[model samples]
Target: MSLDKGGKNMGRMKISVAAVFMCTFIISAVPASAGTSGRSVETTLQSDLAGSLNPEGLLLTVGGYRRWISGMNEEYGIPSSYVQSGAMLGVSPAYSHVSAHVEWKPVILAQVRLQYTLFRYFGDFGALLSFPSKDSPFGKDEVDAREGQEEKDWGQRYLLQPTLTAKAGPIIIRNQSDAAYFTYNGAGPYFLEWEYDTLVKDGGWVVSNRTFLLWEAWKGPGKAALLAGTVYEITRSFSADLTRRRIGAVAVWTPAEGDGLFQKPRIYSQVGVNLEDRNRDGEVYFIIGAGFDHDL
Candidate 1:
C-alpha cells in the first residue's frame, strides 16, 4: 500500500474509535426516563440498532462536507466546479414496515425516498422508491451555459426511482432505476406532464451494484461497536461509462440509552477511496456523522 492507502486505513480506524467514545460519553452524560427498568430499555434499544430492518423510528442527521456534488456519480452529469462546500440534512421516519426518508442539500439537490419491506425470508427483502431533483441548473438545451448559472426560464422535472433490496445475514444488495418526466416552466396545458424522459437515454436503464457486510465487533447490552466491509460501489450508468469504484471500511457506535434529544443515538465514521477514473484521479473522502433514533 502507498502512503495514501495507509492514511486512509488510519482514517477508518479513527472513526471507529470516535464512535466508541461518542457512545460512551453520551450515554454516561444523559439520564434515562424514569420508572423503566434498564433491561426493558435495552431491549427496546436493540431494535433501533438493526438499521432499516427494525423499520420503526425517527432518525435525524446533519453534516457538512468539504466537497459536495450532486447526481448519483460524483461529477458524472454535473460540472465538477459546482461541487462546493455544503451541508446535508436528512430525516427518516419508519413506521411498521414502511419508512419515509428525505434529504436536502439546499439549492443543490433534494430527494424523498420511501422504503417498504415486502417480506422477510432468511433476512429482509424490500422495495425502495425515490423522487429526486431532476431539473438541470441551466436549460437542458443550453449546451454552452456555465456551471451554477440559475436558469430564468427552463423546464422542470419530476423523477421517480424504484429499487429492489435484499438483505441476508451481514450482506445487503440493491438494484435501482431512475425514470423522469419534464414540464416547461410555468406551462399550463400540462401536456408535457404526461410524457417522460430518461436521463440515461442512451441506455435503457442505469444499473449499479452495491454490496456491504456489517458485523458487530463488540457489544455490552445497550452499547455496541460495529465494523463494516464495503464494496461501496462500482457504478455502470446508462452512458456505458464506469463512474467510479470504491472499496472501504466503516465503523459505528450505537448507545441504546437516550440523550435529551433522542432515546437512542448512533455515531458512524466511514473512509473510502474512489478508484482512479479516466477523468479523475483516486481520492479519499472521510465522513463522520451522528444521528438520533427515537421510536414513535
Candidate 2:
C-alpha cells in the first residue's frame, strides 16, 4: 500500500493537528494538586552513596519488557512492538568511582552489551552488538515488494551509547546519545530510497540524541509515584545526509519500589510528533510500555 504525494501530505497534516490536540490533552491531565513531595525513594539511596567509597560487590539482575507502538509499518519507518527478556551482571567498585555491567538478550534479536559508569554516575558509556536470527521479524522481503527490491538481511549492528543525568528538587534531566553502525550481509550497494535516499555500500552510520525533562507529579502511599515529562530527539544518518526530529510528552507510573526478586515496576506512555522527517507517512506516534527488574 503506497500513498501518492498528495495523500501523504494530507496524512501528515492530519497527524500534525492530532499531535497538537494530544499535547494539550496531556497538559490538562496533570493533577493541579500534585505536590513536589512525590520524589522517588531511590533519591535518598543515591545521595547516601554519592561520594561513598564502599564496593557493593557483584549485583545480578534479570528483567523483561513488553512494548507497543503506533504507526508501526515499513511505510512508517518505525520499529514494531516486541517482547524482550534479558539478564544483566554488574559490578560496582566504588574505590574507582565506577561501575560496569554486561547484559545479554537472546533469541530472535540476539544482543550483547557492555556498559560502564564513571565518576559516580556522572557519565555512562556502553557498547552493544546485535544481529537478528532467521526468526527475526524486522525487514522482511515481503515488506519491500513495493520497492521492487529484495530486502537484504539486517546483518550485524554495533552501537555506542552514552548518557548523563542530573536532578534538582523534584525535576530530573537526562540526555542519551547513540551512534550505530550497520553492516549488510549480501548485495551490491543496498539502497533504501524510500527511507534514506542513499546507497549503503557495505556499512553506514546513524547517530541520534534524546533529551528528557521530568517532574515528579505525585508520590506516596508505599513508594508509588507519578512522573510527567517531555522528550526531544534528533537523529542523523551520516551515510545518507538525512535528518529526523521528534518531540513528545510522556508520563510514567511507578507502582512500587523494592529490592526483592521483582522490583520497581513501571508503566509509561508517550505521545510524540515528528517535527521533521523525510521518510515515513505519519507525523504522530504513540507508545505504551511496562517493565520490571529482578534481583538475584
Task: TM-score for candidate 1, please give it.
Answer: 0.39
TM-score of each candidate structure, all chains considered together = 0.39, 0.50
Winning model by lDDT: 2
lDDT against the true structure, each candidate? 0.31, 0.39
Tens-place lDDT per residue, model 1, 135-180, is 3211112211222221223333333444343334434333334343
* Candidate 1 error regions (>4 Å): 1-148, 152-205, 239-242, 276-279
Which residue runs of candidate 2 sit more than 4 Å off their true CA positions? 1-154, 191-201, 221-223, 258-262, 280-282
Instruction: Put down candidate 2 lDDT per residue, 217-274, tens digits, no spaces.
Output: 8865443668888999777767656676878888877675677644545555666777
